[model samples]
Target: MDEAKRVEEGLAGDGQTQLIKEDCQGDLHKKLDRNDGGDRVEDAPEQPMAETAEEQLQVVKQKSKRVATLDAFRGLTIVVMILVDDAGGAYARIDHSPWNGCTLADFVMPFFLFIVGVAIALALKKIPRIKDAIKKIVIRTLKLLFWGILLQGGYSHAPVDLSYGVDMKHIRWCGILQRIALVYFIVALIETLTAKRRPILLEPGHLSIFTAYRWQWMGGFIAFVIYMVTTYALYVPDWSFVAHDQDVPRRYAVKCGMRGHLGPACNAVSYIDRQVWGINHLYSMPVWQRLKACTLSSPNAGPFREDAPTWCLAPFEPEGLLSTISAILSGTIGIHYGHVLIHFKGHSERLKQWVSMGLCLLIIAIILHFTDAIPINKQLYSFSYVCFTAGAAGIVFSAFYIVIDVWGLRMPFLFLEWIGMNAMLVFVMAAQGIFAAFINGWYYKDPQNNLVYWIQKHIFINVWHSERLGTLLYVIFAEIVFWGVVSGVLHKLGIYWKL
Candidate 1:
């Protein structure tokens, strides 16, 4: 994900909720496809027949099982997403880092993407036909992109006409879901290319966890190297950096890269956006404002004099083209976790590998940050930022995996699992202000206007005396409860959103 405005985001799973099916004689059985590499699980418990197909499906699912760990991880990520996105305006840590650094907010999308990678491995692990997998991938990618576009207040805000509706003059092309769609598509494509359908151990013929990890790790490393090289050595900008009338040395450009050149006009990622979409086509919020050069009345006025900042003024999206590259890398890290889950047998071995990967990435991130060779910038999706977020996500999900999957502790997190199962739907609804729409639609004018304001003013603000904390709590409760109820119903009905 990118900046708060272009706003960064997270991923999805392999869609195989119907892994358990009814045999012809009405017996429950888990069908392990020979092509994708799913292990055969015990049959689902028998259920009473229902009159309709939908009801039967619901009944069947009620007795079936799933990878509880994945659901819980996803659930946790979406829960955090709701909390952050709902009241981020009141909390700095929940919104994206202003320009650089990691926050709880930054991990939401990457964690989701990580779940998606794992799900992809799980769902497609048993697919026999690569063509079929490809088809599904294409369809899911399009749907994600569609949701991404719609959430931009595109179709949601009426007219939708060139003249009246969405301000086409500044329609954002890149966004959370759009980036998700692209990342999933690319990652899925990578899976497809590397996938081998040759039978082994009389089981399915699909990309082995071992093979997939190697391909992803190798490709990710190569892509990162190329990304760094182009950004550093080859991106010859028309303008050169100078301070104290001293032109910046090439060594700094090769060493420091984008950190040294934060000008609105500089950086390969922002430059690509300007070239492809121009300023108007990208996101517009807290629009970049360039101050006119002026002499500081006092040298101590700020960290630097008025002349120190870059002069170019244009709001470039954080989730633009190049940052998407880094995002996919985060997803790559997730797929590696996916492999560990699938193939690694020993618990100690699994935990060791998982924590080891996290540590490696963290060490790399620390090195980059301490040396100032690069900064951990979520806005730019810097290498350090990607690695840092991925490492944190891995450790966090690993913990969830232990508690829920291994320990079999389920009751406390069932509500979150419900949210996780329908994560994309919840995010879309929240992002488009659907919760506000319904709540506001049922107007409760109690001195305070909207539902959010009314609830907080009465139940929270009156008690806390802190406007920010109270308002934040109000949003979280309203949105979470609303989505929780909706997802609960959907879950009970055996409905889910998946790609």
Candidate 2:
């Protein structure tokens, strides 16, 4: 999440700044030195060893060369992730689309991939040795995969469910962290492979940046082609799956002899997942169950409709193989933004590049979506979906840059900055329900009488007397704000959990 920064130092004719720097260095140096990665520098000398004013100014400049806006943007994404996951059940529009449209929750995964792309540009800007870069990428990839499988693989049932562990035959293979690992591996390797190639600096408006990062863009395009070809050209035959009703397994057949069908019944995305991961291993309770066609209770999960289609009972993974190919394009779009941050030093130039690219993407998305050529669907990870989300991501990121980096509005967003700095930790504890599980494990008397349940019931629900409003408020105050404060404390202690 690193980006280039400019530091403005105020030097007084009375030599007052130097005196302040000398006094502040003792405490500031310790705090700054403990910061992870690009956020920190070499420990400052206890005494001002610099004999000249120029040397002292260099020290100040070096200490302030990391981007604060990037952290704020990442933190904002984390907050949204918490909000959608915790409160989506109460508000259907905020939840992921049941089949073929975007919603608040659908944006989380792409936003993460977009941020990862920006991070890759900053992280591997200069890879001195290919072997070292490969080693680091592999290690981080393995770690993400491990955590993904552990957290989302049915290993720890939290909150409502006190039980933990899942049968190996039914463990889910793909999820948020797992998809991120795959995307990161591919995108990082591409950047590393092309790190040595120098870009020609043509005029800014003349597709110059595209020419510079053309190889990465080309790679993304190739992946998109593979996804499109498979989705349309590959035939999906009749398939049967076992549906357990009242603990009684019954095999039902679904008719799908089509080559190109984007419906819930048959699509290359779900087909590929079922063929590879097996039906038992896929996500049993997919978002499609919330569709009006399938659910007796529209926009929510409940009893199935009397004539609900057989496919409604089948399992599907949203982060399946074919869809992930389209997701790679999302990461590449992010890389383009990161490259803008790196090559362009001037604020206006950087913003101009970001806004222009963002608008172009949005325009393309609108055409595709309106024409029905590629409907915006998160389940399928449609081309229009990628364009729309990535385009929106670029615009949102630029706004944050303007607000936090340019306008110096840091005080208002300090909470987000803290969460952004320790994003992984918060993702595990809050979003994954690890912290909730732990507190629930220590409940008094009945398992339902946990601290989390009590607070949500007494403090939020009872006071408000509205299920939807109370649930939303609980997530906002108890989950998002509480985690923000925890992350802030961790940030103050100079603690960060990196990948």
Identify the candidate with maximal TM-score. Answer: 2
- For model 1 the local lDDT of residue 29 reads 38
**Where is model 1 more than 4 Å wrong at Cα?**
1-14, 17-65, 153-164, 197-212, 234-265, 286-313, 441-448
Residue 177 local lDDT, model 2: 85
> Per-residue lDDT for 155 in model 2?
89
Tell me the tens digit of each residue's lDDT in model 1 across 192-220. 66667412332223334445357776767
Clash number for candidate 1 = 15
- TM-scores, each model vs. reference: 0.76, 0.88
CA-lDDT, candidates in order: 0.61, 0.79
After best superposition, candidate 2 residue 308: deviation in angstroms? 0.7
What's the CA error at residue 288 for candidate 1, in Å?
7.6
lDDT of 2 by residue, 1-499 (tens): 1222111100000112332244344344323221222222123444454544556445554554456776777888889999989899999889999988789998899988898888777666545567877887888788888998998988878657989998998999988888888888899889888877846244556578888888999989998999999999999999999985448889989999998898999898889988989988888889999998898787877899989998888888998888988899998998888777776766797899898888888999889988999999999999999999999999998898888777878899999888887788888889999889889998888999889898999999999999899999999999999999998888777666775
TM-score of 2: 0.88
Regions more than 4 Å wrong, model 2: 1-63, 200-205
